[model samples]
Target: MRIIISPAKKMRVDTDTLAWHDLPCMIDRAEVLYDKLASMSYDELKRLWKCNDAIAALNVERLHNSDLRIRLTPAILSYEGIQYQYMAPGVFTDEQLIYVQEHLRILSGLYGVVRPFDGVTPYRLEMQAKLPIEGAKDLYGFWGSAIADQLYQETDCIINLASKEYSVCVSRHQKPGTRFITCVFGEEKDGKVVEKGTLCKMARGEMVRYLAEANAKSPEAMKDFACLNYVFSPAHSDESTYVFLQKKSQDSEE
Candidate 1:
């Protein structure tokens, strides 16, 4: 499991920097961090230890831990003000992998839980989930503020539907299986997330149906907030407008 990111043949700032891959490098550090995994412990092996909500317990700093020896060196990492961090697969275990996957779902507000057998995941767990496609980026600060006060507080829900005039935004670029998960909340009538293992699959015709049905009921989405208002690549474009995705891109990490 030893991982070493061989630097490419260019001045990556200093010709000495390369980001670590999570797999081999992570495996290399397995012996050292193995003890930190709950499942490796005597008392918690078989039990799913309900962890501290997603962001709170993340060991981001652990990436820079000493034994594994990760260094950014002098790489020209930022381009146009975008910063990137390297991930090495240090000490990754099956339990930790599962926990990390679930952690992503919780943060992204996607499915109720992460499932593998749905055919898109790396592992084969037969689960699926859905996401709320609200103004996702705008809600990040809100989520942060909510977490600052109290994490995962069950709160109110607001339903967002498309307007009637623009029923569907089709694209030749639109590939199948495009999906996302975003935070959703509402009163108990909208379905409270009391269980930790629910999957909501809104792909293919199901996704088309949901949006179409929603649009027929609400006009504001199609009329006021067409795809051009945001930043991500839109499904299509038209006169005086360009679309941007309000949800996570297809390239986003799970």
Candidate 2:
């Protein structure tokens, strides 16, 4: 069993070596996207969505375990202008937060707001939750109820459950304005290996299909599992959809 926490070569936010203009430009880019989407026609919006999806796939290529299933949408605004909407990893709760903190207390990196320099940490209040063995329905219920009230405007990102017992994770790190992918793999325990894989390119419609399969009572292929993985399903990119995992690799003999 081997556990590895490998940093993405090009994360959503690579702060340590960041240039002075990086953060500002990144923020501006998000807002600019908001503005562009502010008045986008229906057809134009659809085009934008497809383009964003393509970009997400391209970005995922640089990292071993980043979420390729994440989505970027033309974020509608209230009194303001248009913004970006991240459909995946969208919901949260406080109990989930506490549980995440407790679970990641040992790993430390899994809890807390990413430091100013931790560009890769993405959104503030990044935390990890363990998948309850009870069942998927019960798990989401606990999570939705837990963070529903507490995660009002302050909270940013959440790292859902990973399949490996007590040793792995799949996350979505919120970026400055809108977000696409901010992923991480936490500590690995003995005899466990987190295998790295990804779904290179996908469309929103395709993602929806994969999600359906992933969440089925049982998935036949990694693609089906990818869709079901969600923000907290304890899984990553798969071909049926998009699922990445940090698991202990078995020998060829196995």
Q: Tell me each candidate's TM-score.
A: 0.18, 0.19
Candidate 2 residue runs with Cα over 4 Å from true position: 1-32, 51-196, 199-251
Clashes per candidate (backbone, < 3 Å)? 22, 32
Please state the error at residue 55 of candidate 1 in Å: 23
**Which 10 consecutive positions of candidate 1 have the poorest summed lDDT?**
118-127
lDDT of 2 by residue, 6-61 (tens): 12122243223322111211333223323333444544433433445544344223
Top lDDT prediction, candidate number: 2
Error of 1 at 165 (Å): 35
What's model 1's lDDT at 41? 34
lDDT of model 2 at position 209: 30
Model 1, runs deviating above 4 Å: 1-43, 49-199, 203-254
* Deviation of model 1 at 37, angstroms: 4.1
Candidate 1 C-alpha lDDT tens digits along 1-254:
00001111111221133332232212222322233332243233212223333422232223223232233222112111111111111233444333322221111111111111111111100011111123323222212232212112221211111111110111111223421112111112233222111111111112223233333322123323322122323334332232323343467636
